[model samples]
Target: MALTLRHGVFMAPFHALEEDPTMCIHRDLELCEWLDRLGFDEAWIGEHHSAGFETIASPELFIAHAAAITQRLRFGTGVVSLPYHNPLMVANRLIQLDHQTRGRVMFGAGPGLLASDAMMLGIDPSTQRDRMLQALDVILRLFRGEVVTETTEWYTLVNARAHLLPYTRPHPEVSVASAVSPSGGRAAGRYDLSMLCVAAADGAAFDALAANWEIACRIAAEHGRSMDPARLRIVAPMHIAETREQARENVRFGFRKYIDYFNNNSPGRFPVPAGTDPVDWFVEKKLGVVGTPDDAIAMIERLQGQQGEFGVFLQQTHDWADWEGTKRSYELYARYVMPHFRGTNAARVASYQWVGENNVEFSGKRQAAVEAMFRKHEAEMARSGGGS
Candidate 1:
């Protein structure tokens, strides 16, 4: 059977550093609630400590808060940088969180993203990969109720065990972050886990996605584990409107923020020669989509064709549009783009056609009843009563 695509938001949530961090967090929670009400399937919160903008330091804490407000939507750590924390603590918190949220939590693991963040934590950036692998090894074992006794340069545990099990059967959905590298794929496959391709919009990763999954399967084969493409989640930033012109115009409001974010913080990632229009350049690179719902649908379809049928399409919700416009864009996606892949509108369309086809029968019976009433009045008039 074909996989029905689910909608979600991959929120690294780049707010300008100048904005109030407190307000930024509030808005993120609001975004979660908004998505929940709009019927989005999941919302993955980003983890960062040193970055001035991507300030949600603990995705687990944020998930707890967001879960309290939202009813049905699931939450992921968006990747808790495995290199930064003790794996046992990470596993324990997530397991307890799974229970707290009534099993709406996911464990997203990754090597720390920022070199500066690693350095600040007294870690060499080069050691992050090894650190992540070791930490994840322990984390997965703990989730499976194993008593781990592992020691590493950064952290150590002696017979550490998780007394509280995850609410999700087996365990919470564990997703590994992937972009242009085979590390994430290999790790996910070796451990039998899900993959979150966070760089689906990036020019580089967009092309490498198939090869990445292929690497995962190869690694899984070596580990005697099976890989499921349906467990993959692709992330792309998009804004939808009724018209392309409106989308282009609306995206301009936060266009500079987008470029400046990459140019300054994510230095050299976006090579816009300091003079040209950043918004035009962004669209020219095809890094993000800003158009009508059809454009959104087409982008998703193309992703599915290129990367295989993924379970989720996560909208990268940078502060590209203002609050109201952001909400409106989500509404457009829910009303139009979502139904296309999910095939939700098929049932509604079928019912409409059924009603149209069956209407003639109803009208014929009603017409006959009216004619019989008229005939009875005509007889009464002939017998001495007059029809009004």
Candidate 2:
């Protein structure tokens, strides 16, 4: 199979113009328009409920509107929080969006972070894994046009069927965002789903991600199944510019905003080990690629070599809230980085062909917690008839 370099948009809620929320929406729309013109393969929106910073709480609604405006660019939820939704309803919405976009929809599902959001909805967050597995089974079955009736500890669906069928046969491509977790890799292998390894500029982190993929591939072989390296994806925060200095300056201020946001939300203050400052680790590790066009392309090539058959190069310019810089970065990456690998085929390895199963018992307790909370909210909504 030929290797395809998939370009995608990472749409974060930009509150640059804090006084006017609509302006942020418009800016995001404009960015989408630019991506379409630039020949990007997909645009991924994230799902975050009640997060004051990013307003795209409902990605399905946003992507539906995006479908109307763009002709070729695909729309996706970098992930829709599965534990928070009824799988049947989400499956219907996904299929509808796929049809609206004319078969250009990719599904990225996850059990969300943020305990406070779950708590507000009265969810225990403890049973999140069970919820994710059950929900995933339902959604996948629905996409496959199966009449599913499943009773799990957390959820029960009795002979539920979807009226809205996805345009893609057997459903559109599905991916899960793995944030440095072995469970993510195992899940991808277990379900035959794509594993999207989230990358920062850090080489060490990238290496660790590659190791996880190796484990996933090995596990798949044990189950008498095989995974193509091309099916693996890497999502990185990247910005490419004319010059390295310009790239640094362009991304610095915007990147700082994201750093502040994460730092503020991080729980517990652990003392740094004598030689390891997080900032230094980030730059040394290259967690977020901020460099000239040539440098960015080189970094991607390096990542591809390590990760194998990397499919998507999701450029996250919006995270910085610098529209002009974001546009420029996209253009630069398109002009320089994409051409080398866009249509190349993912390389195959003999070692990854088949292996014995380790019978890894992965647990998703956090995922369960989010699901329980969301189900409670769904129940309340059903009683009141007030939710979508």
Candidate 3:
């Protein structure tokens, strides 16, 4: 089995749109609908509690809404911070969500980065590793329809049983968010789960992350299990257009707003390490992909070659308020970039080699389109009496 490249949504208010908190939820839903119509495979929302710029603290709640509106797109939490809440409750919610979405749900969990978030919840940042592991174990058990009766230092659940079972057999796919950490990758491999990495500003950073994933996969193999690169997902900011200059302009416009907000509000939150300017970091890291369709395709090819088979490329459109820019980018991507990567059997087969062992599955809409196209061809052939 080979993994195919699957398109996904990274629901976040990354640029100027972060300023208007209200737009965060609305924009994400709007994007979800757009992606659904555009034939994307997955829609992933993130969770961040009390981050000044992010309002998606309750990803499940938002994703539930997205699931309701869309008929086929798979919904995922880009990541839910696992250490901040009770795992039992989270597990129950996931079970409910899986049912609500009729098994089209993926769970991505992580130990959060922000100290402010951890402090607000009385979670010790230092103990996050242990807490995360404990929480993951608990959730996994609960999702498997087992009774979990346990008391951990951070949480207590006495004979907890999920009222609803996940729609996916066993459970929906589980992913771990790994950024600048081997721990997350290793943990994912140990549990036979998927790994999703966010490479902040550098291709090398992405390479490093991929190396860690490979190591994790090897470790899993040693344990009589295997890790599939096709199951690995990456999140990045993407802006595509017909011309490189146009794409650059669109990104620059969005970047200006993002830079202004960070400087004014959380000055040096993403501090330049000694001599590097933030802008340079952004370019070198490949945090934002702004280029012609061909250029964007080349970058994706480089990533696939270096990173191994990736299951999903979750693109975060800078922000929705910049509707024209976002629309242009996505339209170009759909018309030029996406088609190159989708539908064809050769493309699908190549995707597995580039992405990993899992076969890329189409969402219902895409499946229908493909079926209809075949039917049309069949009908035309019949009308011509099977003429060549």
Candidate 4:
């Protein structure tokens, strides 16, 4: 059977610095409602502290509010920066969320993303990944009903156990973030967890897609576990419009701010040479799509070609466009791009073709039936001496 690719948003909640922070955050919540109404499968909210642009600090709190407003859209931590929290607290909160959402919660864990955030917390950037792994181990144990008693340089869990078991059987779908590193793959392989390839849009991470999956599969086999491609999610940035030119224009709203954030704060991650057009560079590098649904389809097809089969395509949500334009982009994606991959219209298309192919025969039968009815009516009229 072909994989049914799920679609969602990975909202770092990137907003322009000039926008009011409160309104920006509310708009993020509204965006969740908009996506849910558009039939998006999920929305993974990010956890970032120091980044002024990617401002949502608590994904859990955001998920709670967003989940209440939306009916069906599942929420994820987009990764709960595991190194930043104690395992016990993380597990408890996740369990509560799982129950609260009625199992519509997914737990995506990762090492903290912003180096500045880590610095403020007194966590060394080098140790974040290791700490994430350590935390994952304890969180898993707690979920499985184990009383964890362990000590690490960063955290100590002394007989730590969650009071409530996860509402999701076998626990809410656990996923780890994978960018360019093999660490996410290793952790997923060992724990038999899902993966969130957060930076699949980046050229370097794109190149590592197959290699990282290979590492996961190899390590899974060694651990006597099997990695499911259906559990793997690839995230990339995209903005769609009615036309390529229109999309390019739409992103002009705040694309510069996004570029500035990366170039100034996190340089080299998303490099745009001084003179080159940002959108052109972005598309040329195969970093993402900023065009029509056709372009989005091509980007996804490219990813499918690279990684074979994966479960989800998470659009990295950004303020590249205005509110209405952003909403329209998602609506267009739902109307066109999603169905292409999902085969949502395959049966409908087949039915349409079958009807069209038999149109002559069906039309002939309808004419014959109408003629027969007229003839019967004339015979009855003649018998009654009322025929003309």
List the global CA lDDT of all models: 0.87, 0.72, 0.75, 0.93
Q: What is the per-residue lDDT of model 2 for residues 1-388, given as tens digits with 9 covering 90 to 100?
A: 7576777766755453243777777777887888898878888888776646666788888888877888889877877878888899889989988887778788988776656667776777876655776788789989988898877655678899998778898798888767665766777787888876654334445668777887788888888888876667677776777886777777665665565455555632222345664434444556666677777777777777776667777765445526777788888877766665654322333223322222232235556778999999989999888765
Ranking by TM-score: 4, 1, 3, 2
> What tens-digit string does per-residue lDDT give for candidate 4 at 1-388?
8899999999997888889999999999999999999999999999999868998998999999999999999999998999899899999999999999999999999998899999999989999999999999999989999998888897888888999999999799999999998999999999999999998978889999989999999999999889999999999999999999999999999888888898777778777888999889988988899999999999998999999999999999999999999999999999998899889899999999999999999999999999999999989999999954
| Residue 203 shift from truth in candidate 1, angstroms | 1.0
Q: Model 1 over residues 1-388: C-alpha lDDT tens digits? A: 8888888998887888778989989999998899999999999989887757787888888999999999999999898999988888899899999999999998889998887788788888888888889999998889889998877778879989999878898999999999998899989888898999998878889998999999999999998887987789999988877888888788777768777767675778888886887767776787877888998888888888889888999999887778888899999999888888889889999998997899899789889999999998889898884644
Candidate 3 residue-wise lDDT, 136-182, digit = tens: 98899888889988987777899898878888999999988787767
> What value does the lDDT take at residue 195 in candidate 2?
74
TM-score leader? 4
Candidate 2 local Cα displacement, residue 387, angstroms: 93
Candidate 1 clash pair list: none
Q: Write down the RMSD of all candidates, one decimal each.
A: 2.3, 24.0, 10.8, 1.3
TM-score of each predicted structure versus truth: 0.93, 0.79, 0.81, 0.97
Model 1: C-alpha RMSD to truth? 2.3
Which model is ahead, 2 or 3, in terms of TM-score? 3
RMSD of 4: 1.3
Candidate 3: where are CA atoms >4 Å away? 15-19, 200-204, 260-281, 343-388
- Could you tell me the lDDT of residue 332 within candidate 3? 76
Point out the higher-scoring one by TM-score: 2 or 4: 4
